[model samples]
Target: PFRSTSLPSSILRSVQLCIQLVSILIFVRVLRSKSMEEYSYTMEMHQSQISDRSMRFVGRLVQRRTMRWETIRRWFPSMVE
Candidate 1:
């Protein structure tokens, strides 16, 4: 009778340990996935910002070129005509 009770108690303790280990693993996995998602989001934001700045820069460059052409036309109307 003593051995039978002791056997059941030992088995219960092992089962408890397995549950604890599984819980810990799941927690770690969740944390890692959250961090990865955050990292990807930040990267996307940075890329969008960079692209926006480049587009603005190109627009300004085109405006400058158009202004230069207008100035040339004003200076030498006969050449254009």
Candidate 2:
């Protein structure tokens, strides 16, 4: 009769161990998900920086082209005179 009671107690302990292990696994998964979100946010920030730089480069290129065209137009009248 003592052995029978001890067997039930062991079974309950095993159940508790299993529950603890499952909870740990769930916690690790939650941490990994949060890390992924942070990585994606960082990547988005880098992309925005690259886009802003490209836009500025394009604007500068356009301004230089217009300046050169005006200079050429002003010199053409003197050259033809």
Clashes of each: 0, 0
Q: What are the models' TM-scores?
A: 0.34, 0.34
How do the residues 1-81 of candidate 1 rate in per-residue lDDT, one tens digit apiece?
345555777798998899878756754664465333333333343344556776556445544566665676689767644
Residue range 1-81, candidate 2, lDDT tens digits? 446555787798998899878756654654465333333333343444556776556445545565555566578745422
* RMSD, candidate 1, Å: 24.7
- Model 1 compared with the native: what TM-score? 0.34
Locate the minimum summed-lDDT window of 10 residues in model 1: 34-43
Clashing pairs in 1: none
lDDT of 1 at 25: 70
lDDT of model 1, residue 52: 72
lDDT of each: 0.56, 0.54
